[model samples]
Target: MPEKQRLTPTVYVSVDIEADGPIPGPYSMVSLGAVTAGWHDADGFRRADGKQGFYRELRPISEQWDPQALAVSGLDRTALLRDGTDPAAAMRAFTDWVERLRTGPDGRRYRPVMVGYPAPYDWLFLSWYLVRFTGGSPFGHSGCLDVKTLYAARAGVPLASVGKRSMARGLLPDLPHTHHALDDAREQAVLFANVWEWDGVSRSG
Candidate 1:
């Protein structure tokens, strides 16, 4: 008989970020949050039993920012400048958190996968800062999952038609969509877990 391939355990970490502009460098990721949403392997998937999260507000790296982008997050740039954590320190702390998650009690290492609602926006800022400040990213170059795209694929619909409003009610998380980084991260955690376990027909049909 042929040997069965062992599936690697993957830890899904839901992440959210509030930025002062559309991209990194010229802009800045002002606030960011991440939560261990769940883990999956050959056995099955399970959601986090309790909240395991990390959050940080960072000082702007550049003075240039879009006024509208700042308004969307409703964070005071002046206050962040004075009180926010340093970018290097913040990225280090975030990296440490991810490392902790990757180390298992049984000594088996798990892959840490980053999950975000839309993903690209958050990944752009996160990857840039991690590489810039920490010299590397814990998620590496490709350890990201987009919940929106997952839902779109599972539902067999065009990505553009997969907004919350267009999704099935059962697949939606009950959490509020607050712009606060931690709150949104927690919300996304639940949403990611829901989508991970979904086995449903396409709503488009």
Candidate 2:
């Protein structure tokens, strides 16, 4: 690939998931949320406008559950069991939604990259579900961009030392971190934008 093409603009897809336990097969991803953060080009980051978001609650696949993990999301396991979207159908729809966001208004095909506060956990469930149900991932296997790691590198701090509270006020969004999947996904999109564009200046004023 040419240098220019390799550096082509990106469509950042922020993703969040709420699960019943630590792992996938033994547990379940109760809910999932995803949204476009925006286009990032030479100008800067601009949050996506009028782009639809994706959210789905899925029925549990196994009998194992952790009380603390279940409590955090507050999603009704019983309700999900009764009326949640099927995992295979939901994964297919999620991939389709992601594919739709790849084309820009000017006809440019942007690379769709998954953005997460801390990519591993979300990526774990998301990748597993995508590969398991849809047989592939729209963002590919290694396309996730971790906001936490991004901040740590840009801030010249140890990765473990970085936290949202430690970031510059301006680089952090005003949105609350409600544990709801969609709300947190939107909030995370804004956060990835801010951190990605920050100029290494700590802006508290």
Candidate 3:
């Protein structure tokens, strides 16, 4: 029989999006950001646990822009219109970056899971964007991991109390602010690391 692959909890990409409503789709994704982190080997090759990756923003689709969402994210539509890169280009760039992380600077192949605090909320916009503009999902179906759920389970807390502020105060203790996707993603990563390292258990598993 083939060797069973151990669940090496590494290579995570955290995505966050500010959308117009509880759900994405016609509501529109106003802004998006992501951060990838893990461990790297001596050659700068991302080992399964390499703490190396990217954080970036993508311009919202002009025709599908949501005023209500913009109000919440505070991203300037006028500026985006004038200077934002195209959504398709942004998505392509993001995917290319992900590939670089998984492979090597020279190009190789590796697997990384996309992670988020509330996975579904962020994934909705990211998945929608990839499908709409990036041709296909580079992260794939097994790509997503929900740190919110994991933390709740590990700390014996309710999911209702697992938002950014809640997690920061309870688990992180030092994380400040919310709504900024990259910051939030980093906070969740730190929280996940704490739970996984100190507590010594796969919270999600």
Best by TM-score: 1
Name the top lDDT candidate. 1
lDDT of 1 by residue, 21-48 (tens): 9999999999999989988766578799
What does candidate 3's lDDT look like per residue over 48-137, in tens digits? 232443544445454565577677766677766666667788778878877766764445345667877678878877887887887787
List model 2 lDDT by residue over 1-205, tens digit each: 3455457788899999999999899999999998888887655567774246899999888889997998889989889899999999999999999998889655778889999988899999999999999899998979999999999988888999998888877887778788898989988988888777787765533
lDDT of 3: 0.62
Q: lDDT for each of the candidates?
A: 0.88, 0.86, 0.62
| lDDT minimum window of 10 residues, candidate 3 | 41-50
Candidate 1: count of backbone clashes, pairs at least 3 residues apart or interchain: 0
> Against the true structure, what is every candidate's RMSD?
2.3, 2.0, 5.2
Off by over 4 Å in 3: 1-10, 20-23, 39-56, 62-66, 104-109, 161-170, 200-205
Cα deviation of 29 in candidate 2 (Å)? 0.4
Q: What local lDDT does model 3 show for residue 69?
A: 65
Clashing pairs in 1: none
